[model samples]
Target: MNIARPLLALLVSATLLPDAVAGSFSFGLWGDMPYEKNNDAQTTAAVIRSIDRSDVAFSIFDGDIKDGSSACTDEVFSRTAKTFNAMKAPMVYVPGDNEWTDCHRKNNGGWNNLERLDTLRKLMFADGRSFGRRKLTLEHQDAPFVENTRFHKGGIVFSQVNVAGSNNNRVLDEKECSTKSARSAADCEADNAEYAARNAAVNRWIEESFAQARQRKAKGLVLTLQADPGFDLPETEELDEAKTRGWNRPESGYKDLMDTVIRETRAFDGQVLFVHGDTHVFKLDKPLHAPLDLLPNFTRLQTFGSPNNHWVHVTVNTRRPEVFTVRPVMIKAD
Candidate 1:
């Protein structure tokens, strides 16, 4: 018997298992929280406890383990990892700008932004499995982009890209970079180069994820990341309209990703949900293309952020037309 080949085949087939094979399941979503002020540690602990007590199969943290002004020290990452590992449900965390890209700020310890990003990648995405007691096998991208991953749950394809806020860390001005941190003009140039490289990797990941979903005939696809992506603007249009005036700025790092998303979502025959946490405010809508010209199959869910220290419970069922339903899970105040 060719056990090795059969075993490989079985593992490959598992990724394509149909949603009908399993019943509906729910997961938790949250991010941009637990700042170093306002009694945040207690508040975040309460939020974690609330999640632990929930019946969700897994949880997705969109990003920001700490606030922008805090130090991006190794201790912060280690402590956060410890907390995540303690969770009952498997936790999928995306990197946030506050943790790495904006670490170049003096208040954030004036670290080299790229070095901070590498450190975060090493500490958090140290393996192919998720955090928490339960684990999920994730297919990670190539080196330096391992944080980008694709996993399957309930017949839905889920992708987490290494995209963050702060204009996706594209330093538009050398002067601005120097003023914010102690970086020289060369440092700003290097930062922009880093952004360019990561942006390319992210674009490839987004495209490949959609391709995988289509190949596996997934019921729906959920794209999770940390940036807001500025859906208010007509990201797909070259319009002179008031709603899309600043859509082509150099610092707008999300435009390319947005373009790829609109294209891929239009091509896929499944329900597509874009989840992010930057800019907080707990929003759920179809803000793609434009306000009036929204993508019918696409939906956007922004999880609750700081001070608001709550989470969103998302239920995915292949039998439903929408495929995903979301509700806010509020943590009771002590």
Candidate 2:
């Protein structure tokens, strides 16, 4: 009896021992969900299904809601939004170049690109403030509109800037602009005023959000956008032409915003993950910059879209304060 009792006690001691360790949170990241002729509805459904099946806390679509030339029709926009809304977990969207930047095309609304941008602002960013429900809002009136949107489960800080690929100038066609009467000019002026106000609001939000993150001592930051700041290397002839026409890099305003974020976030002691689309290629590169010189713990992730649609999965663990892992999930269209 004594031997059996002692054995049972030993087993209980081993089983009841505490295994204390920090937990991790997983998130899904996708880019360039072009809801145009190229990306079939069935494929889009499959991607959504995959997201639904996964255990990620949330999903992020980097940008490019449709092809640049696709009409920004209500039906198209609604369908795309509906598909995305089908995901099991909530989704956060960052506008890409194709959504508004290239809406100046003849096939698109043919309206003032800036005005169309306003439409996007109303639709996707309805709150006129935060991204999702993170209580982050723009707080500056300068270049980079400061906005805060965070995923609490992952303990990640999300900041967005309203930077477009075409130098933030979605120029209306000559004929389109000229055809409008004087009355239309008044309307355009009003639209411009509203746009300016929103831009300033976003800038303010960004500054305040960064400051807040620092104050709270956040563990990591995730910055999502459509354009790649580093696109078009060497500034060669091809690069220059592409940049000029909005085919390659984004506008100067976007570049300036990226620089500002990179510079400001460097002060903190945490990982910074830069997620973007626009090039329609899935890439992961560790940009070489002085540690603490730029955004500390910065990792650049660009997921593929359109023909090679894919997604990214990131895991954050507090146990290992030194490193955070980002894993890419490539959902190829079958």
Candidate 3:
């Protein structure tokens, strides 16, 4: 009888062990790179060298591989891809406004934005896999919509959507278009329609990520985008100033996307990390609609970019409740 009791206790202990007690791995996150105003070439090279030296599972460049003021040349995409491939870790990239959305600007060579977007897809992501000597298995949404990508590693689900800054390419006033581009009112009208459709696609992709996370029972979800998605801005006065520009008050563009994201985060059992790069600073904070009051498990990570010229180092551990611990790695911090 005593031997039977000991056998039963052993079975119970074996069944109670937690989900493979999580392992840890680090990865890199950086973007809004090669800005013309900064010490671009020198800084970008240094940042690349630094990442190569570090031990990382993979690296994600959040977007804006070229400066907004530069030409949306095919060469830029190829060159950046080469730089990304040089990293020892796999590289994942999100799309940015400067590369496609704002390519219609006269300074950007007066190119049709959609045409430029097509070029970007062809040159940068045509392979349907990430850049690097070795590639990660990514589930892509595909083709014209190649920017939306998802992958899972170390019990964490990672994804990216093409929500860039510059009001997310939502506004297409003909006058503004005429000033920056030789395109017609008809073309601007088409651009507006494209904006609407893409925004809808982004909204759907945002919701899908959450559903996929739940299905996988992932320990953490990381949704990376290129837009800042303004949060915690000063209310009333300063907010009014910020809101005047569609870029600062993208809630108008992101209302439905944010609504679903917030709803899903509340239902998810693990931590959520919302990452972006347009703001060009290294910021880590709880920017949920109510933070401590609601969605307590969510965190926002804004990567270093432009003048700052640094990258983020994220340590992901399945055993930790937070799932991800992030820190900025300033390659040449002053």
lDDT of 2 at 54: 79
Off by over 4 Å in 1: 1-19, 233-250
Query: Can you list the residue pairs that collide in candidate 3?
Result: none
lDDT of 1 at 237: 59
* Superior by lDDT: candidate 1 or candidate 2: 1
* Full ranking by lDDT: 1, 3, 2
Report the lDDT tens digits of candidate 2 across residue range 148-218: 24333334566655555544432234433334222244544553464456545545555665676676676
The number of the candidate with the highest TM-score is 1
Residue-level lDDT of model 1, residues 1-334, one tens digit each, is: 7799999998888767754575488999988878876557777888899989998999999999999888889999999999999999999989999999888889888998888888988999999999999988889999989999889877789999988988888878757778769677888889889889989999999999999899988889999999887766544556744346233454688878887988999999999999999887898887665557668999989888888899999998888889998999888656
Please, what is the TM-score per model?
0.90, 0.72, 0.87
Q: Candidate 3 residues 1-334, lDDT tens each?
A: 4799999998998667543343578899989989875758888878888887898878999999888877888888888888888877799999988898888888898788888877887787777688888788788774567778898886788989988777776664656668766577877777778778887887777778888889988889999998876765555554444344333344366655666778889999989999989888788988665423656888989898887888889998888777788888878632
List candidate 2 segments past 4 Å from native: 1-23, 127-151, 170-202, 235-251, 288-296
Model 3: how far residue 140 lies from native, Å: 0.8
Tell me the lDDT of model 1 at 39. Answer: 57
Please give the TM-score that candidate 1 achieves against the real structure.
0.90
Residue 135 local lDDT, model 1: 87
- Deviation (Å) of 152 in candidate 3: 0.5
Query: TM-score: which is higher, 1 or 3?
Result: 1
TM-score for candidate 2, please give it: 0.72
